[model samples]
Target: MPYDLKHVFASLPQMERGQSKVISGDPKGNNFLYTNGKCVIIRNIENPQIADVYTEHVHPVQVAKYAPSGFYIASGDSTGKVRIWDTTQKEHILKFEYQPLSGKVMDISWTEDSKRLAVVGDGREKFASVFLWDTGSSVGELTGHSKHINSVDIRQKRPYRIATASDDTTAGFFEGPPFKFKFTIREHNQFINCVRFSPDGTHFATAGADGQIFLYDGTKGELVRALGGEKAHSGGIYSISWSPDSSQLISASGDRTVKLWDVGSGSAVTTFSMGSGVNDQQLGCLWQNDHLLSVSLSGNINYLDKNQPTKPLRVIKGHTKSIHCLTVHKGDGRSYIYSGSSDGNITRWDSDLGLTECFSGKGHTNQVSSMCVNESEELVTCSMDDTVRFTATGGQEYSGDVVKMDSQPKSVSASGALTLAVCIGQIVLLKDKRKVFSSDSLDFEPEVGALQPGGAVAAVGDAEGKIHLYSVHGSSLAPEGPLLEARGKLTALGFSPDGAFLAALDDQKVLTVFTVADNYSVKGHFYGHHAKPVTLCWSPDSEHIATGGMDMNVIVWDVNDEDKRIKMPDCHRLHHVSGLAWIDAHTLVTTSHDSTVKQWTLTY
Candidate 1:
């Protein structure tokens, strides 16, 4: 492998309305884990930008928990399979794999010694399973609830006990090493959403869709009291986490607020209002050491500030949807990667620092199809919403300067004061943030477009596998020379930074480069991708070109030497590469349908 993975900005946890997202913290309190698609993401509690992804699951993962010993993590998926892998190794080598049930595994709990495991979720014959961590031998009979279980927890102290919350509107209790169901507490009329035992192991709490919170004795399974009288929150309570000392706890509710409760007084101590929108609903929460984190229905992680109830200390944001386009911009002696997702989100990542921040204010309302940076250091972007927007990179905010296109834009390119947007059936040109000319009556349907670095010409690739050369005179594009032919339908087109070469990729898995100095003559043809190439970018020095394809491979081709290239296979496992950019001559940036942005360092 000539390229090594330098950094990974993992995606946020996938969110579902009316469902709780399980976020589990490691015993050392330094990191937390969550499930996103088939991968499990582990991020540092303090510097979340430092992250890792475990991608061994064959099914969409539902829950992941770090063992008490902190040596391994057991992740469960929708197929009811649980994989226990080592945490100490970078490979996360699998220690064991077991299928505990026949359906989705909603939650998993490990005993204090980390030797026993309890798994529960929607199953056909059984709703819960308790077995030894090493051998798949049954350690207990976890039965009592008649419906699917939502949560499970084991007492961390002596006389280990088990507790579960279920859709049957009941909480079940169990006891002993060979655990057996002791009794069922039916205190709520609605489905239970979460169950947890205090750190001290003296009491346990259960919350439900009825917005009720019930406290029970951990040792005897006796009702201790309700947290907030009849109801703990104005809306359904989804999750609760106890403070390290076990004297207080925080609960996330669908009412768009997380409340801190004093266990002894059974009253709310502080209320953290998330927002008023439907996407602001709080879904999950965790109290790790001094940090209080909560997840919103929008998949953003909020850091709660006790003194400031109205605003969080920090809100971590990233793509919760697949990324569709990417562009790199260099300004103020630093490089930044701007990524656009299918859900119309544009996030800016600091290439050197691995830090991320999103553009503020209303921007694109649909998927951003293409992006480019102009001489003014402004980001010019086109979207499926029929508009081209110019956003300021320095301020990291949308400028609101927009150019409406005649049709949905397929690609956009910018150089100096000239911007070209190739739409479904139109070729629109803009100068100084305003539309100057648009040609709706063209002979070919443009699939992609690129403007020369000197703004002298515009190259538009059409569905007919030909590149139309249009000379840019003022604002209008005049047809130039004969059309450049390709082997198949064009997928991507780009002009070299130095204006010496033009690169085009096609559905035929071929890369063709043309020497602009030699009357647009063929420079060389490269082939390596196993599938259709979707995106391409030129190196800063114009010496190399990088292409990403549907085959999940990224190949760097040397323009001077057609036979010399670097091939990186499986760049993003199980997902096609959607976009590619160059941070520097030696560094490559790639985005994929997996919703993650990765940086790779090229050895050559």
Candidate 2:
């Protein structure tokens, strides 16, 4: 008796990004933070692979300071959606949606008491507003700026002061819950990027695109002095941070440099130049305890601890595809990886083990669709859901209870610590039993054909003859559409043993190989045997490639020698071989539409 079944994978503890336990202090200068393109990430640091207390969000653009209690965080996104989530549980506790004018929220801040939060962004009615953190209630009205706000900061002491920087080239100062407008200071000729309060709450500083730095008495809002201008940075200054003693300030700029300035003398003390003159253009910076965390325009989060030199202590990475599978390796605390296609192929990978292993199995009944690889390397496939089954290297099968799907599962991928299943034309994400991120219109609506995930990259093939690539960054995710444009329908996709090469197939009966770091290309195409390739695989050494197609043949091609081709001479003489897998450098496996799985030995 066969039936469709949905099983609950055990739940592990959830982690929030920016949680104290995850990023207790700033990392050494060489480390960079990874984001899931939404709001989640693993914090790799001096410790041993800790995966807890990281940020999680749906449609979030940016998150604010941790409240004094450290129990929650205020996050805002491009849709003008603001949410307050429990830091420990990674759950959204409160939400504030302002779709009318919600552009990208540039920054958010919390007062010392943690009772109030301020959100500033590009909006229609108003550019900024102050609100209560616990409730979606407005506490103060935003005034003064006629342009987009770039940054905001709340004084964490008595006589609470809120300061905002804007593209209008001015800094606006206001007071509390009734947030009355104090006075506007015209200090910079360009946009002010950031404002910060000293730890003692006595003073603050502002850095702007004009390359100018200004310091003022926190209590008076009166200008104390202007330090550096055009001579300070060859480019715009994007973010600023303060030291514990309040004796010095650190500013990151578009010029690819970080400068430490002495408050009293208002002079540069030490300067650190990012390597190779790449000019990464640091855009965001934060000071936690004695360490400094800075964000670059290219989505890199850098940790700088003035005490260390050689390299960063750690680097965290993530992705945005609707996670379809997750396998945490036992014993060694390692994990392997696999993802299904939008059309119907399954790719296996060695993730946590530090090696690339892609196993191409008999494709899904429909499109090599949805899949899950457990600790045992047994992959469960869920296609149109008319049938649920498990597939292994030799095409082994486990009868799974069938649960019919309302629509074909177009794209299946995984993120965070969960697997996600996506239905066509739907934005809602099904996380086994829970629902995660979603949107109104995903813009592109092609039947997903193939999928694969590893090393911060998720590849999904679509009916539009395109393969989309997504890069997972901590909390800031974006999709690179049509990474590989095919001349025909992309039927399958895979990664080489080292993950350096991405393999793809099209209805044209061609096998295409690409460098994952770049675009899809002709690594080597199996043109000798198959008329229309249905599936492909890379040998264990990554030096050879195997392919199966409608021509009823299983062919192996030596990637290093394009002139030679190996053929099993109609291994499935009566039917098309629908799947293929390279078991080792000298052996392989195959499955045919004729409902047969065969083992084959590859001779030189």
Candidate 3:
């Protein structure tokens, strides 16, 4: 037998309201990097779904910057520590570590030669530092600001220079091999949020919370001209990126707009309205190659189309928050994976190429608790928002058919055209979003629901450790057979693809399998988990069952031989597996609160 991890679909940039987020692109314009929690995500710019994550830092990471040479990456965290690691290998071995400041390191920059580095953030004694990249020795002092430094940049030419933007509303300039503060530009009436140098190294720009943009001579550290004269955006500018040719620039703002400007004319060339919602506010952006990318406060990344000013070519959507539920659908000769996050956003991904697209229209306003694919190739989802919705598989949008529940929906399962959902204390059956049947009354607290294959029988698990068997009528479920008892509260339930057996996971760390034809009696009990199992899926051929638990482990059990089990431990380090699905007979996909999704391949 052979089993190993295959690929990883990394999470989006962690976004927060009223906070500034930074996105950095490699020199070759191949990949982009951003910080999320304690991890730094690196994704292919061409195909955002192809990603890699570095999770070495213990503290929440604030910023990451790519070295000029594009071989090493340096990331800074809230603990004021910076770790430099090699990017050429999959392991990303750490090369060196340094304590740059005393508090959160908010921004980082690298010299053109990749020999020196600058970091700025909140520090008890000093707000920023400049050091030799490899030696971790002090190169110069970054002082002058009376408050936290929010941004930093380094000139890439012969006469290297440094600049910093601070909450004190001053933009400072420095010059040196051993850099030292030269002067302060007090042109802004509000805090400066971003400072960047043009690719040509001839000019630099500063964007401020006051909605103003000031251009300066990069080499002389003198004022050149103010772009847009009085202001560049209606709202505070969060970030700015220079075009490769150094002739134009793009700015992201809190006004929910992204604008392209001609640096020479100091006029806006085009303005792209992201949206009207508060989450539409632009937070960060990047100008690399032919792509002009911008990040909204919602964590959605937009690829702006200069030709079509009103609409972007694409909007990369995913959860910056934890994901709880997901399901796979295969139809029209294509495979799609739909995942719902804690924030209620749903994303559909092409299982083959990893291309992701977000659903449009109104969606769940809270966490989605369970999801399953139905006979029509549509997705049925239950949410904590007390609603169950039907979404089309190919259209990637809600079908406008929703059922409001009396209580929060806990779990949902579907077989053919029959759908069954377990709510707080009742079991409901629906067909095409219309209620077909409802349980008269319940004596047990239903925790989960499952529908046997071929749409014949429905099973409901209760907190009392009893599995209630139900015979599927046209639209309702009728009580049938005796109660299947468990050792603890039933947390999860699933049926084998062939509908010959049912599997139940309880709080007591035991998994009980029962034969469907044997009046749902216990066929066997598979046990070995150290903690409560939260999710389970069956192998395509019904020969194996995979389960992920609170112990941070995933186990592949051969149903015929309980002793033959494969345990993949510490799947997400410190996070529990929140959901699981089978991509194929030989592949398994797992997601965790850690904001990462891993795909594993098995050969037996």
Candidate 4:
């Protein structure tokens, strides 16, 4: 491998309204795991930005839990398949796989010995399954539920017991090596959302949509008492996590608040208010050692501060949708990567600090098609909402000033004080943040565009595989030369940092570099991608070009030598590379439809 993966900013867990998300922490309390799309994400508890992704699952994953031994992880998917894999290695080798049920596997639990497994979810025939972890053999009959089971748990100590919560508003308890359904306790009036056994195996708790939490004897399944009088919260409780000592617990509710309860006194201790918006509803939580974490409906993870309940210690934020475009900017001796997603959300990341924050104020309403940084350190972006926006990167806020294009923009470019935008069938030029020229009359349809760093010319590629050169005259563009032809329809175009060369990629999987001073003569024609290339970026030295395509590959082509190229295959598994940029000559940044931003170090 010519490049090493230096950092990965993983995506947030996929959230759904009225559904409970599972966040599992390792036994050592160093890391936590969650599921988003078909991939399972694991991150360090202390530094949430340090992350890893497991991409072997063929279906969307629902939950992932680490074994008590802390050496392996068992993740379940929508197809009811559970895969147990080794966690000590970077490759994450699969240890075993089994289809325990016929439908979605919502939750999973392992016994104290980490030998037996209990899985529960929405199955057609059976709502739950209990089996041996090493073999696909049944160990118990998990029955008595007439509807879908929402959560399941097994005692972490001796006198093994299993518990499950279901939509039937009842909690089931079982005990034995070959666990069997003992009895069903009908305590809640609405659907039960979660069930868990305390770490000491002394008590178990169940929370429901009726805003009630019932404590029961872990061994006998006997109801002991209810927390917070008759109700624990104003809205439905989604999840709960018990303290390690089994004396207190925290519950996350739909009312956008998480409350700490004292089990011995049966009263609320402290309430942490998330927010008042709909996206602020708390969905999941985890108690690992001294850390208390909760996930909101907006996919933001909050670290609870007991001393100050009003403000969280920190909130980790990132994109929850597929990223479409990205750009790199250097200011104050620090590099920053800005990414835009399909949901009109933009996130800025500090490359050195591994910190991320989203832009505030109303911005684009649709997919961000293209982005580039101008000399003024402003991020110039064009979106499918038929507008081009200029945002100050230092302030990290939208400027509200927008330039409305005549049609939906496909690409945007910035050079000094000049900005160019290519629309569906028109072209627009802007100066000083105001539109100065527009051209709706064109013989060819433009698909992408680029601007020379010296603000001398604008290169626009058409749908018919032609590169149309236009010289910049004040704020308008005038035709410069004859149309340069390519092998297929043009998909991406870019000018080098020194404005000495121009690179273009086409649907035919061909990359062509043209020398700027030689009458736009071809410098080299390179071929590497197996599929159509969609995005391209030039190195700071203007000596190399990198292109990413639908083939899930990124190839860096040396302009001086056509045959000298480095290819990174399967850069983003199960998704296409959507954007590319360079923080410096050796540092490359890539974004994909997987909603992740990866930083790589190129070794020349």
lDDT against the true structure, each candidate = 0.93, 0.57, 0.88, 0.92
Q: For residues 350-402, what per-residue lDDT tens digits would candidate 4 score against the true structure? A: 99777999987799999998999999989999898999999998996799869
lDDT tens per residue, model 2, 233-289: 766787788887888888877776777788888888766665443425555565655
Would you give me the overall lDDT of model 1?
Answer: 0.93
lDDT-sorted candidate list, best first: 1, 4, 3, 2
Model 1 C-alpha lDDT per residue in residues 1-604, reported as the tens digit of each score: 6889999998999999999999989999999999889889999999998899998999999999999999999999999999999999999999999999999999999999999999999989799999998999998899988899999999999899999999999999999889999999999899999999999998999999999999999899899999999889989999999999999999999999999999999999999999999989999999999999999998999999999999999988889888999999998899999999888889999898777798877889999888988999898888989999999889967887988887899889999999999999999999999889888888888999999998999999999899999999997889997789888999999999999889999999999999887989998889889899999999999999999988999989999998999998988996888999999899999999888999999988
Candidate 3 lDDT over 406-511, as tens digits, reads: 7888999987777888998788888777778877478889999899898778888999899988888787778888888988999899999988889999999998
Better of 1 and 4 by TM-score: 4
lDDT of residue 602 for candidate 2: 61
RMSD of 4: 1.1
Task: Estimate the TM-score of every prediction.
Answer: 0.97, 0.51, 0.94, 0.98
Q: What C-alpha lDDT does candidate 2 achieve relative to the native structure?
A: 0.57
For TM-score, candidate 2 versus 4, the one ahead is 4
Q: How many residue pairs clash (N, CA or C atoms closer than 3 angstroms) in each of the candidate models, in the order given?
A: 0, 42, 0, 0
Q: What lDDT score is found at residue 581 in candidate 2?
A: 53
At residue 298, give the lDDT of candidate 4. Answer: 88
